[model samples]
Target: MNFDPQTLRYDERGLIPAIAQDAENGDVLMMAWMNADAVARTLQTRRVTYWSRSRQAFWVKGESSGHVQHLVDMRVDCDRDCLLVLVDQTGPACHTNRRSCFYTALRDGAEVEIMAPVADPD
Candidate 1:
């Protein structure tokens, strides 16, 4: 059966959560939102694209940062409310320059930095 982006469940805003994972390492990199258009764009372009709720616009990964995420595969959750995107990621995935956005760990009721930011690309 052919896949349809519209078939996936979306919130009232027509958005769904998308998780990015490292294709080679199986490490979760980040989570973002995606509208149907963004989903189509990502599939068509083979590049991960997301909807920026804050900016109210389409955000193509690495558009300015050069930390692009090339889509290796895309998966839909059982409920179809979320997506898993396996990708070949370049550079850091977090705005803080860490390899992943989930760099903090909650241990013993305290937050601990589990990973350091990547060195400046320059």
Candidate 2:
């Protein structure tokens, strides 16, 4: 059975949550929103693409930062409301330059910075 992007459940806004993860180590990289078109583009191009809620536009990962995410696999949740993207992440996945967007850890009711921003290569 061929998978279709429209078959996946989307919110009223026609968006779905997509979680990107490191294909090798299984580390979660980041979470972003994706419309059906974004999903099709990601699958077609093998580059992870997202819908920026704030910008209200298509956001292709690493388009500007060079931190590209090459899609290895895409999985839909059982509820068909979420996506898991296994990818080859090149650089910092967070806009803050951290390896992942989930940098803050709530430990014992206190927020802790577990990851630091990646230094610019040059």
What is the C-alpha lDDT profile of model 1 across 1-122, one tens digit per residue? Answer: 26689999999999999999999999999999999999999999998999999999999999999999999999998999999999999999999999999999999999999999998856
**In model 2, what are the clashing residue pairs, if there are any?**
none
Candidate 2, residues 1-122: lDDT per residue as tens digits? 25689998999999999999999999898999999999999999999999999999999999998999999999999999999999999989999999999999999999999999999888
Off by over 4 Å in 2: none
- Quote the lDDT for 104 in model 2: 95
Model 1 / residue 43 / CA error / Å: 0.4
Give the lDDT of residue 47 in candidate 2: 93
For each candidate in turn, give its C-alpha RMSD to the true structure in angstroms.
1.2, 1.2
Highest-lDDT candidate:
1
The per-model lDDT (C-alpha) reads 0.96, 0.95
